[model samples]
Target: MTEREHSTVVGQLPRTDVSSPLTPAMLTRLVWALWMASLGLLAVGATWTGPGVAVDGLTVLMWVVVTFFSGIVHSYSRRYMAGSDHLGRFFYRLFAFTLVVMTLVAADHVALFALAWLGMGLVMADLIGIVRGWPQARAAGALARRYFVASGALLGAVLALLAWATGETTISGIGAQADALSIPVWAVAVGGLILVAMAQSALLPFHAWLLSSMTAPTPASALMHAGFVNAGGILLLRFAPLVTLDAMAMQILVVVGAISALGGKLLKTVQTDIKRQLGCSTVGQMGFMIMQAGLGFFGAAITHLILHGFFKAYQFLSVGDEIERTQPTTDHESSSMGVAGAVTTGLTALAGGAVFVALTDKGTHFGSGLVLVALVVLTTLHAVRSVVGAASVPAAVRFVAVPLVAVTAIAGYGLAYRAVDVALADLPVVTAPADLTIVHGLVLAAFLAAYLAIERGVYERSEWLYVTLLNATQPDPETLLTSQEEYNEY
Candidate 1:
């Protein structure tokens, strides 16, 4: 291999290697200005007397998340990638991506949304391939480009059909004019758009690019996971009224998302590297998000988008930091506590459902609300179990801790649900149908069964699947971790 090919970081700050004129100071100032502008526009969006703008509470919330997280990523990358030859260009592309995302969320016109949607793909291409000379990074960029281009075309076609149906080019105007569900052609358009979302979201057949993303810098990977992938769901939100008009589109999303979610979860277990594990996690998370959109919980999906962005972004940027991490060690008595754990989480969810019923007259989303309660319960159970002490620990303490954690998680879910429910009341987004609840329940049960199987050593005994996943996901330690050191020697 050539000397330059092996080098991951450049040591020289010589002006000769600079690709773009962007400096640290300039990027910092831009971030500040971007946040300030987003906040101001948010207020305007809420109260603007304009007929074309559709800035709702959810939009404002998403804008804040995108802007705030973009700033965090920019600052972290500036330091983490301090010595890259294309450092200036790197920040510039990230900035551009941030703007495109904000525009995608902010625009109420189909024309503007289309432009921003495609622009995001273009910027993501550059951002993902920021390592420039690396062939693997370039290939990842190519894959991303292919998905984004196809997504953009499908979205554009959907928009054209919408405009044709209602003679309205603006998001709110079209929704105001169309009874799209009655029109079979428009229903077909929405289905096409769902395909676009599937592609853009890295679902199943399209998910390879997401796994290949470790070639990019950590900040870039974080941006894709936390911010970029959510763009697909956001796009769905924009056309949700029409999207909900089609049953086939909904079925497509549910089936594809379920498959992708299951695949991602299974792949994650066997991956040897931390970053690959996170990548698989994202694939699974995005699948669930798509499922949320399919179920008509557009608002809930947006909420997930923002929360997951914060979570995965924090995980990525905080890598290698001196954060306290809990390691799992099983206790003989802990196995016996499974019944208690189940009781705590189950009661917590029941309480959450009760609260929802008491507070809201319109239970338009009982199914999704119930799912939220279950998720909170599951998370709390995991957290509590991870920290469970030896059998010697006081029974009273463990009992108290389990319920307390469950209640806290349930309460958070309830509050977030109520707020989002109110914000999205006018939109068509809600829980899935009653019949699908059984399907969802069965899926969750299966996931739990798999978890127990793995915890109980089923996976360890399965040598073929375990070895195959490890081989596919484990990075070359010498090339990845030691490249910079070796380059320094050279």
Candidate 2:
């Protein structure tokens, strides 16, 4: 060999023994073959006779596409870093694994979902341990450690509780209908686990983790918040039969899901940062799915789960461009927008809390008087917050005046509907569920308005944080690059 070639070989990083493990080509070919096999079966199954087969088969196909794309991206990322140091190699491996597991999850096949979940959990735990063992003062490492620890702890507690509950018949049998016989312990446990995970997926009160986890890079956030986060809601829908068995749990699921759905929508409207907006939107979308499940609309929930996953993944990708456009340009970064314009932007928040309370307590029923009062009060408070918190005059007017105008119009319309029904009624059917439901539906429409307002506020706060806070809170250099352009630009 030439002297220069010998020097180059000797100077390479110490951990350059790429030959010990399976070769890249071998791994790639193996994964590619499996992916193709899954896709082929999915296509065949899609045309099968049964309704359930069509749904399940299509689900399988969807996941195959997700995984196939994820694998391709991972491969590209890996090859780009192939000649880098040991640390680069390690990260590429992790990124690739996360993508593959996420793709497996999207497929929505029960067996594959379980296998991928367990495998990913183990991978995350191992990564955390490895980082902790290293002497590096890495903030990203520290954040990852916290994430894995919290995630594992939460999952462990639920699993243990489930195991104990499964051993006892009392929890399992309590929800059995009078006509039906014993229910499976595993079924109950699975429902409970999914519910807990769904909550932790950061819907409403559990949302702190989504913001905190921003310490991670955009890609990780994209995968976790935009993609995998949807799993919790889907998981619950998968166990809809078991969830319905427990009436109290079912009600809680419905109410909480409703609140989360509205809350998430209200939060997303005003956000400045692209990722945070997407994160809050995910929360809302998941809430909607959970609501469908709670209402015994399992088919709809599954449909939503599949659709939202695709849309959210696309949104996350688009957000990268938005983030790039707003990024600081120098040591003293120029602002993305002028202060006057920023101040003038009015957003409606608190709309969710108000609208949610209103619909639940609409007083359409004889016994719901107190519920109505509570809802009215909550709505008033929302009006107060909107007026007081308004960034501009038009915003304040819309927040306060719009709802008042809406409520007045709804009550008047309801009275008119009732009067007309009564005036025409002595003849045929005076009272019907359809008529009442129609009134209730109108009331529900008002609540939807309020939900939009609340989401606007949430989006604003998120935008503020993303634009200002995230920029200010520089990540630790040991684990993250100073500029996204250096590592992320394709």
Candidate 3:
């Protein structure tokens, strides 16, 4: 061999390392097969039940379509497909559309119940599989994925056994013997499945796995966070009538949703990474969905799910655009707000929260008085901030608006002599006129604060919360299809 050629060969050898074989085609086929099987099951389910024919048919159809979309996602596991971000986006919308269909069809007891058990278990397992096999997935993430798969599989098997033991493979007739059996068998199945699904959805306490799952690819993150993650809540909406059976469970869902929404918003305030912020926001939003389910606001929850899925998908897709723009650049983190603006916002938030807390147990006189005081302070500070910061808008403003309105309305209602139930219809009027006035004023102030935050290059606290909501249960984008040397296949 020539000396120069030998030298070149030796130099190249140190730069290369062996890697796990690329098996995108295999992954694609598996996902495709699973999608087809889910559709087949839906078809079987539709025909197996003789009654509620229309409901069953629609439910089956929706499930089939969603599964197909999920399969398409898996199909794009190939390296060549990774280059086409648009294909990834199309799958995202399909997944979202599936959620919308499921939400609408789940209103039927049988369909809701069947989907809760069979469909949720399958979907969770699918997500776990994809996350586990991701080429660059972390050890902890892979372990978490396996745990989800095991748990989901175990749950599915248990339900299947329960159905068998009762001599009822279909959800329509399993509980027909007992007095309580007057409730459709679907309700029992749906209830059981919804509980498990909520845990998988990461409503609050079961939320750690969701944050960890963020280490996955961005397309995976987009689909899961924007659409797939909400599958549990949608499942719950299907069995809305049954969720009321156990009052404690209903209350728990409500409280979890409340905590997730409020606490998640607070935490999002501090996150530095883009993905983590969105993940936390997702946790909060799902909490809202759960709360709606608890309140028997099935319709509202479904609507929220649809709107959120669309917007969040758009937001995640934009992340890829941001990545491409930033890739060739250096650090560009914006500076924090000036001291005065920060202090004003902090004090306003504290006062708002304090008033709401203080009034929860108090009578009309004290509650109204406190609410009025808090509202005035909040409004004044908000105005001051807006007037001063009209020239330096931040990019995060758009994301934060949704949560700000929600929190403001919640806090406003809490501080008044009114109950702040999530079911929009159930929200009562304020007995105290002062409290009502304060609520109106606070709403205006919230809008002002949001505007000011945007103008001052400051991310509104709610925007941060939204980011957390998006982050909490969503996947990270960078790990999805990067060409960076550090992430490149060997």
**Candidate with the greatest lDDT versus the true structure:** 1
Residue 157 of model 3 has an lDDT of: 57
Taking the tens digit of each residue's C-alpha lDDT, what string does model 3 give over 163-279?
A: 555654433343342224334554455456655656656666666666666555565666667666666665554334345555555555555666675555544655666776777
lDDT value, candidate 2, whole model: 0.46
Every candidate's lDDT: 0.69, 0.46, 0.49
Give the least accurate 10-residue stretch of model 3, judged by summed lDDT: 6-15
Better of 1 and 3 by lDDT: 1
lDDT of 1 by residue, 1-490 (tens): 2122332443344344555667765776787677877677655555332444566655666677787888888877766776677778888888888877877776888888888889998898878777766666677677778778888888888888878778888987776665733567776777787778877877776776677767778898888889988887877776776666656666567667777776777778887567778888888888878877766566668767777888899888765452334556663454545676556545654554555445432244555445544544454555565444335557676667655655665556556756666655545444443234565666567667765675576767889877875665544332243366533432
Worst 10-residue lDDT window, candidate 2: 426-435
Q: Which ten-residue region of model 1 has the weakest summed lDDT? A: 1-10
User: Of 2 and 3, which scores higher on lDDT?
Assistant: 3
Candidate 2 lDDT tens digits, 37-69 = 667766465432231122343345445645554
* Candidate 1 regions with alpha-carbon error over 4 angstroms: 1-20, 40-54, 177-184, 246-248, 322-386, 389-397, 422-445, 448-452, 464-490
- Model 1 local distance difference test score: 0.69
Q: What TM-score does each of the candidates earn?
A: 0.81, 0.52, 0.50
